[model samples]
Target: MSKQLIIDFVSEITPQLIESKDGKYKFRGIFQRADVKNGNGRIYPKKVLEKAVAKYQKLIQEGRALGMIEHPPDGKTRLDEAAIKVTSLTMNDKGEVIGEAEVLVGTPKGEILKNLIDNGVKFGISSRGSGTLIKRADGTVVVGEDYEFLAFDVVYDPSTPGAFPETIKESREDKPMELTLETLKKDYPELVEAIKKEAKEELRQEFEERVIEAIEQKVSKIREEVKEELLSDPEIAGAKVAVEGILDILKPFISEGIAGEHLEELKEEIKNLKESLKKKEDEIKHLKEELERKEIALYIEQKLSESPDGDKIREAGILKEAKSKEQVDKLIQEFEESIRKTINEDKEPKGKGVNESRQKLSLSEIHRKLGLPVIGG
Candidate 1:
């Protein structure tokens, strides 16, 4: 395979362009991620990025994780015109490379970067690299282990109305290629998540019809078991006797001429009633989802409307992307488990006879008690 030139853009929103007190500026946010498709439709396995980030750290330590104000003529970082000095670079547990870069003062190009930022011009962080490209028959491009990290350039993101949408912009073809994390994720791994996501939402939308049907089938089987249990258990003899008496009365009617015809009609009536109950269950599920959504929107508006940096957080659209939200949720769960283990070591709590002693409450119960969505919808 031919060597490929790769450019992966990081969202300007994920990182803050902090204005330092002494007339300096720094950019900090996620620089890269592993085991996911980058903006270029290239997959870098966790191991691949783990190794790359480890090696790249050495360059950062050397103050050589340099980059220019803009992409150079042929995918190179000319140190003499370097505009950014990467102060720190490290990967998080989720395989995202968090980086900090300071705008260098007393440099011609660096001054230009500072000016653009002051004027509210946004810059997307993009990496310049080269590697062997493997095209999966499925149209996914995998970045091989031979992949290398060059400088993280500051590419200007046009903020004007007519500017290209971030989704479409990453798909552009220059001699060098650029990838937006959103586009590739949407096109590939995320595509799977997107497809299932709606069904899952409808599932959370409450008692999905297919799901209800499955439960009804289970209930039908359980009804026979209930009858057997009731007949066998002496402690419930009253219930068993009542059931037997009803059966004895129905037995004559079930066998006779006019009464047998009436029994068939009664069975049909019961079936219709069951169908009506199913529709009611479906309706109840929908109501739960709707109530949860409205409560959430109202709470956010009333409590967090003026939240600090909420706009940036929302605009960076990190949590809003959903894939990242899934990552955060997993990490949060892992952390909760770790904390529970640490605090209640060797001593069981009273309620569940487990650590933390917290009441095990289903989200639905919690939502019923408080005005909250039952779960992620």
Candidate 2:
């Protein structure tokens, strides 16, 4: 099974914009580089980079190296938003893979992403790949050799902002140190405090909303219970019957006499009528089952009379033993077939009587009976 990994890095864009005649804003940037310890404390080894480079080159050659912005890195969710494409990839002197990509400003999402990039919104590129990771004891991970490079997506919500610099420095020492949450608080305490305040307020609002929802659910349940109790009360039931009786007596006198208050009584009467109908239906079903059973018994009796071995079958108590019409029919069929087989066996002829005659007399007895002497005596 292949695992997924997202490689987040800053794009190193050139100053000059490559203008196009088709009203698309095009810019060049190195989307990712290999052999560097990224924000996740992981490195893509040379072998892994080579595999990715080869796969990406094939994709570009087939014009299928399309990518998107802010999409899921796992490729679980699909959106038809191809905002970027890898143009070329090459390995530098330090065995690092460098790649250039073009952003298509023709798409709606691409146009928005382009506008953000132009306004210095500070986004990074994340390369999505399916592979296995080998974690070392030093807490650094390396991508496996069987890695498949999928797409480089533009990510706006990077975990560490300083990991992606707007400008690429010649040396690692020249780049700013990777920022931690603790380090960020120490550097910008006021901004950290504002974020905390906002988070607390948001949590408080969520808790309040949950409490209100729970209370509303409880209130609705209580109201339903109260309504059911009232409906079942003896006093309420008597009053409803009395009101219905009065309405029935006055219905003929008044033209539009049935008021809103009588609707409840009407509903109760309808409920009672439905209950009566349901009971009648159940009774009808039971009667139908009884009729079917009697019909099956009649069929079994008729078939038993027509059976050839009816006397033997009746003596064996097969009719009483059979619980259903199917069992009775099976027994009848078996008995009739036995009778037919016995009749067929009796009609078959016996063999010749030559052995029987020879056994009846010895050789000397046969000669005396025929008035002749025995030859071998």
Candidate 3:
């Protein structure tokens, strides 16, 4: 026969602590503890649970972390039997699997669990999983490293020693829920600020990226459409010569020379055409040079304005390369990216990475995440 449902009941959620901080039915408690012998005469080592908790973190983030009202009928987490949305699960320095799960009050099993929390009925955290057991010489059973943490089932009876939440909730008894922003403000003000800061920064960055992406898509489409419309005159991008017709008219005539009186007329015409062509060529050259110079100057301004490394860049030969308009266009695309990035960096709040280490989610984020909204911060 397969292993019986291994329900390691660790703590009881007493009615006295049934306070929902923001109408979100949530609970904070230790699901399973390490190195603590329970009433079942079983001990779970820290190393064993550490690996399990680390593996189980994926489920929590995916919103698949679930629990049953009493216990799971089988090993797999069934959607029909699921009653809790296990959001935040982590191990503290004490080697305890600290967790915060929201009761799924919408489903049938959830309704039952909600009624239990509402009526002040006692419930406890029971971690369900399968693992090998080690029998010590003293007859004490230790949960081995093969332990696979499945889900946290909130139950009524706990078999672990001091399994009551009063033991686990010793530090957080006065608080409603740990993930709530209010509680975070009091306990970890810096982390709370970090959440707000990082949330805004990320949202802004995401919005900017999305907005820029959308604009770029639209611009690209319009650009393609314009290119198609101008396909007949690809040279429209360059200067339009009003006297171009004169060149077309004179070309055939110039190819065939005239004799008699028309010969003198043709010679004068050739002389005049040469001067006109030279003047036009010089004019076009000057305009092109002027445009290219401006582009190069603008490129240099944008590059140097970003940092005080103009001398270094010149010494490195990066800026000494061809400063033509075509090269400037590529440089504008490459180095000007810093302009947008700098603007975003300016909008970023101070102490940005302070909350990066913690895996715990915030209550609003949990609710926003639709739970423990990964819903949390």
Candidate 4:
């Protein structure tokens, strides 16, 4: 059974704006380094990279070093349409493999990719290969010898992009050379069993990590919802300071190592405290409303005493019926108008004195006295 492994690295493509006549963009950077821990926390040893050097050279010679824009190279079948082609590859003294490639502008996909690069779209290179992986006891994984070097494709996914030469140096001390068949059977009988056990344990650990992450996310969402629901209540909203203080006080006891029964008891206590706080808050709100109503009544009484028709307004019970200062002001105005009308009626002549004075005044005299021009004699 052939297991698949993909190694990705950041390859800087230096575009040749003036050197090349062919409208193709040129890129040259380290494609692979030996004995390096890649983004997946796995190391590719020197021997493995050395073996791939010749394979890549052969692919370059046969004019078959082609790769896609974003997708990985199809397995050993090697029948996928390509967007870029590798022209040269050379390994350095540091065991870092550097390569130069040109973006194929002839094909439709290649033209699109070239346009994207020219327009400043960032792209990185990723290598796809097939191989089995060996996980060490220290959690470092090594690619086996069956690894085959495949095409390097242009990708847009952002990753930790840097030369991994330091990683290569560090992996050398921790990871020893691979054991031969004779050494595996004669010297290390437990090697095969350990590998099997480690693989199962690694899978279980990965599953557990995913499950824990999902549970934490759900818990966080539920906590936010509960907080929002608590804040929506007017009584609770006013007591947010007290609630936060209580939560802070109880937070240390709510964590791991506390027994479930004890935790439930603490929760019940907190619940009782919250209810008691809410009841006290309700009492405070009712008292505040009563105090405000009494204040308004007192204000109305004071305003009535300042008015000239205070006795009459108080007799009508308007001051007591008024709900607000504005209502009391309006009632006072109405009472003052009634008092003024009564005074004016008492000051007027009781019999025909007023009617006789009005009849004595002639129509022309009235018009002239009122500063009007009389017409038609």
Candidate 5:
């Protein structure tokens, strides 16, 4: 069916609410019923349907509870490492040695970080210990608690932590250099949203166009058959001659003795055919117009999505990238012609033999390559 006819049919089938403002393209709403078993089985806003499907998929994935992936830490020339230095090997209650281990955590390797922050290095320390009791039963000044082992290793690198470190460093206060969080968030949001939205809208539009096209084609077929029957009806033939007078039409027909039952049957058939044809014709008109409107809208949208500049994108000399009104119009014309050709070809009968089928296919291909819409003369 032609796009125009399909649009007319849909408009007739489902009462449409149409609104056209000066600055905006027309919007159409198709009325649908509620019963899940009825024809309105899957009526919903296109975006809403996609979101619902995505949400369901996410729920399923969550229910499965897929494990988190742990990729190997990136390899680096300067290692990020944390180490524990054994301070002192002490004897236990028996003649055993007990070694105390202490780990110090820091940013960058001792050498690497020091060089990066090229500023002068200033070190300050605070000691913690238990004062000793002595000297004439009074308190005595002490340098610090017995410094059994003051073991400190320079943090040349830092290793990522899984749990609390086994070793503990009882030491001074220190701070390391850090990267600010704001910088990471600022750069990626625009790119992410654009990709997601474009993909979603593209898929929704494709599905919708296919469904509308199918409905239009089916309705067109029904209308064509009815129209053919109506044009060939004998009652219509007899009606043309009846203008001469009732006696004139009956004189020739009475001699042949046409059956009354046959006339009744033909009348009934014509009535049914008329009703069916009218219904289908209306539907085809509605759907075809809707399809064309949607196609134009889609093309305009895609054109707007291209570069902000006015330069037309070159696409195999076809000018698929529409930067101006002229380009958009060209695309629409090309698409309509191609679609119409396909519909006409689909109406033809297929060959029976393998060789005949192959030849037919080859001819079809040649016609396509030549940019001609194949039709039976």
Candidate 6:
């Protein structure tokens, strides 16, 4: 079985214990384990194991944050949102809004620098150039190097608790420029529409291929119905033997892209499954035989208890093993006749005939003889 099958079986059986804190079935343990050799003698995927460990660590962190942890780790605590800054925004010549932020370090007024400081938080300082580059297949950078950039200022606030006593000021260097939407459509409309048309054609081709596939599936179904009808007619049976070959033809249509080695392995698996089913049936047959023997023993015991006399029991065919329904009926008729004969002799009848004294011997006894489990008796 595959590792996925093992996980599925575990989840289906005793889901509660294996469930994660997130209320979902988790394979954390499986992921954390080292690669093991499966029954097929192949090593398990090590990546699957590593993934489980990472998920387990994430769950631990979540549990710690939620206070569901029993013993939390003692370490330096880091706040995720402590470094954010508030500032003003201004649109530059390049259609980009520069967020001119300020953070107070020592006082409100300070020197503006481009370098980063250890304690001071710099927010909204850098102005990144905005443009898309179209590279060639030769790995060369695209043309249109006329891109423009913008600059912003960073200021600090010291009123908040634990705030650094330094004011951040960004450098005022290059001014911003813009490439407006109206300007692009007016001058570069041909280039833009050409790209759009190419994309539209590609989408149309993909949709056409899907339509063809759907029609082929409908055709395949119709062919299957006709083949079924031909196989059913005896007059066409001789000629229809070739129609069955249509299945072999269709097999390639369905399994066409499958690798040859994989197809061979699939056929071998079907053969193995047939062999396994045959073995199970053989085991059932053996169990049935043992059940028949135990049933006979039960019938004999019941007959003896009903009529204590030995001669009467022997004449009734009580000890005989009936292999068929006809044989059993004959045995019952003989027992009834003997009981009637005994009654005519004027002696008191022991109890009843073999049929009357019949008991339902549980199949459990047969299962015990065959070393298999039986349903409740």
lDDT of 5: 0.34
Q: How close is candidate 3 to the true structure, as a TM-score?
A: 0.39
lDDT of 1 by residue, 6-51 (tens): 7677567333466557857887888788878765577776666666
Off by over 4 Å in 4: 12-14, 73-80, 158-377
Off by over 4 Å in 3: 1-5, 15-22, 158-377
Query: Could you tell which candidate, 1 or 5, scores higher by TM-score?
Result: 1
**Residue 349 in model 3: lDDT:** 54
Q: Clash totals for all models, in order?
A: 3, 0, 12, 0, 26, 18
Clashing pairs in 4: none
List TM-score per model, in order: 0.41, 0.38, 0.39, 0.41, 0.20, 0.21
lDDT of 5 by residue, 196-232 (tens): 6877989988986786687568657756765675567
Most lDDT-accurate candidate: 4
lDDT of 4 at 17: 43
Instruction: Please give me the total number of clashing residue pairs in predicted model 3.
Output: 12
* TM-score of candidate 4 relative to the true fold: 0.41
Q: For model 6, what is the C-alpha lDDT against the true structure?
A: 0.36
lDDT of 4 at 138: 75
In candidate 5, stretches whose alpha carbon ends up further than 4 angstroms from where it belongs are 1-180, 183-258, 262-265, 305-377
Candidate 1 vs. true structure, TM-score: 0.41
For residues 133-210, write the lDDT of model 6, one tens digit per residue: 332233332212222221111223213443321112222322333446564454344335655787798997787567
Q: Candidate 4 — worst ten consecutive residues by lDDT sum?
A: 164-173
Worst 10 residues of 5 by lDDT: 1-10
Of the pair 2 and 6, which is ahead by lDDT?
2
Question: Could you tell which candidate, 3 or 6, scores higher by lDDT?
Answer: 3
